[model samples]
Target: MTVKQPDLSFTQNPQWIAERETHWGPIEGFLKENNRKEVVEQLKKLFFTGVIDNPEDVREGFAILYYPLQTAEAWDYLFQDVRLNPKCFKEFMNASLMGSYNEKFFLDDEARLRFFDYFHPATYQPVIKSRVPIGREQKIVQIEVDRFEILRDMAAKFSQFLGGSEVPVIYYRLDYFFSFLDEACDVMDVSNNDKDDIQYFANNFLQRYFKIESDLEPKNRGEQKAFLVRFYNHIANNPVHPSIKAIWQKVLDEHD
Candidate 1:
C-alpha cells in the first residue's frame, strides 16, 4: 500500500537504528527505575527543555534538524525551521531522532505540548531552553499542540511507519495514543467539543490508518468475552471518549 507522505524531512539513515538499539531498548527500564513522578520529571527535562547553546553554525549532516539561533525569517529555512525543539536529545546523541527504532520515548511536538500545558497551566509556552539532564544525561526537546502542521505531519509520518508494520507496532501506537490522549484530557482540560475532534481523529487514525497495508482484523466470538472484560478495564485505566468505547461495543454486537 502506498501510504501518503506529508511534507517532512524524511530520512532512512540505517545507522540511527543501530545507534538507538545499541543504547536504549524499550522505556520499561526507565519506567522501572523511576517512579511515575520521576518519569514525568525526566521526560520534561528530556523533551520539554529546549535551548540553543551552540550558536556557532550548522553541523554538517544534521542541517535538517539544525538549531536556528538567530531570528530572521529571511535568513534561511535552516534558521527559520521552527520544529518542536530537538535540542534536548539530538544534541546529546548526535542523531536524527524519531522512527520505530528510536526507543518509542521520542514524544512528537503534540505530546510535548500536552505535557507542557498539563504541567504549566499559567506559564506562557516558549521555545524551552533545555540543558543536559543532571542524572539521566539524555538531551530532549519541547513542543505544543496548537500547530496543525505538526499533527498533520505526525499523522502522515506515522501512517508511513505503520503502513507495513507488525502487530506490536499497532498495539504500541494504539496503547500509547489512548494513554497519551487520556492524560491530555486531564492536562489540556478537554471539553466535549474538543473531544469530538479527538474522537474523529482517533477513529480515522486507529481504524483507517492502521489498516492501510496491514492485515489486522476484528476478533471472533471465542475472544469476545476476554475482549469485553479487558475493554472495561482499559476504559477505567484510560478513559477516552464514550463513543470510542461505543465503537468497541458495536464491534462486539456485530460479532455476536
Candidate 2:
C-alpha cells in the first residue's frame, strides 16, 4: 500500500493548527484525567492499529501523551513503534534538539552519543555545518562552542561505532579558531607572551591538521569577535587536542 505523504505545508497554517487541536482535544483531556498506565495501554493499541497517519498529528499526540509522564519507561513506550513509525523518531529528534520538548524528554549526553552512533559518515557533515554557527549574536564564544561540542563529543566517543569515519575537514576552519582566541584575549587580560604561545600552537595545529595557515589579526574587530565567540565556544565545549584545551584554559585564567 502506498503511504500518503505528510502535509508539511500545514506546519504554520492556523487553520491546520486549529484542526489539529480540535482533533487532539479529546485525547488530551482523556490523558489529563486518566491514569497514565491506562492511557498508555489505550494509546499503544491505537498506535499499533495505525490510526494516526500525519506526522504532525503523531508529533502532537506524542507530546500530549508524554508530557504528563517523566521517565525513560514512558519514552520507551512511545518509542516502541518507532521502527514501524519512523516519522515519530524523526520528529522526536527534531523536537529534542530544537528545545520544543521539556526537560523530561531532553536527550542527555549519553543518549545523544548513542543516537548519533548509527549515523552514516555522509550525515555528519551537514549536522556539523548547521550547528557550527548557532549563536553568533550572543557574543559568547564559549556558549556556542559548548553547543557544537555535543556533536563533537558524540563523534569522538562513537568513533569505533562509526568505523573511524571522519567528518569533512572543511567544516573545521583555522581562522575561526584564531578568532576564538582573539575573542578570548579581549575578555581575559592575556599577556602578550601567552597570546604568542597560543598563536604558535594554533598555527602549528592548523598546519598539522588542515595543512593551512590562518590570519590571526582581526580585520574587523567587532565582526571577527562575534564570529570567533561562536566558533571558540563550540571548540571549548567539544573534544580537542590536549594542547588546545590547555591553551584555552591559560587564556581564560587571565580573565578579569
Candidate 3:
C-alpha cells in the first residue's frame, strides 16, 4: 500500500488577512478626510490658550483646509495680506504713562524705532496737540505700579539733570492723560456685552486706586470735542513733559 501524507494548508486562510486589511482601511481613509480639520482645531486651541506665539500656524492650517474646497487663487487671496500691529508702541507708551504695566519695557530697539517712524512729529502732532495732561493733582501717591516705571525712570533722570521737580509733575499729568487711552485701546476689540462687563468691573476697581469720582460716565460727543482740543494742545507742548518727550526724541533721533 502507498504511504499517504497528511494534508496541512494554513496559507488559504483568507479570513485572517481580510480582517487585518479591513481594520486599517478605515483609519487611513479617515486620516485623509479629516487631517485639515484636525490641524485647524489644534491651531485654534493653541492660539486661544496662548500656547503659540504667532498666528502663522493658524493661517497655514486655514490654507490647508481651504485648498480642498477652494481654488488655489482663492486660498492665496484669503491669506495674502497678513498684517498685525507691527509695534504696539502707542499702546506701550500710553500704558506706561497711565501707570499700567504693559510690555513697553520688553520691546527691542527695532520695534521702538518702527514706532517712532509710524507716529513721527509731523504725522502725530495734531493728535498730541489735542490731548493735554491735566496739571491738577487728582491724587497723590509715593509708589506707582510697574507700568509707570518708564515715566518714573525718565522723571528721575530729568530731576538729576534739571535739579527740580518740574518733570515729576509732567510725568504725573501724562500718566493720567494716557490712562484714558489705555482703557480705550484695551476695550476696542471686546464685544459690547463683554465691554460693559469689563467697564463695570474696571470702574469699581479703579475707584479704589484713583481719585476720580465717576468712571461709568460715557464719553459723549461734547466731552470728546473738548478733550480733543486739550489733547492737541498737550501734544504740541509735549516738551513741557520732560521724561516721555526726551525719550521719544532720543528714540526718533536714533532712527534718523
Q: Candidate 2 has which clashing residue pairs, if any?
A: 141-229, 141-233, 142-233, 145-233, 145-234
Q: What does the lDDT come to for candidate 3?
A: 0.32
Each prediction's Cα lDDT score? 0.34, 0.36, 0.32
Q: Pick the candidate with the highest TM-score.
A: 1
Candidate 1 wrongly placed segments (more than 4 Å): 1-163, 166-178, 186-201, 204-214, 217-233, 243-256
Overall local distance difference test of candidate 1: 0.34
**Tens-digit lDDT string for candidate 1 (141-164):** 343433222223333444333333
Off by over 4 Å in 2: 1-56, 60-68, 82-240, 253-256
Off by over 4 Å in 3: 1-80, 83-110, 122-124, 127-256
State residue 207's C-alpha deviation in candidate 1, in Å. 4.7
lDDT of 3 by residue, 128-236 (tens): 3101111122111122222233323433332222322122222324444354233233232333334444433333322222222332233233332343345445545
Candidate 1 TM-score, true structure as reference: 0.30
- Candidate 1 C-alpha error for residue 191, in Å: 10
Query: Candidate 2, after superposition: displacement of residue 219 in Å?
Result: 38
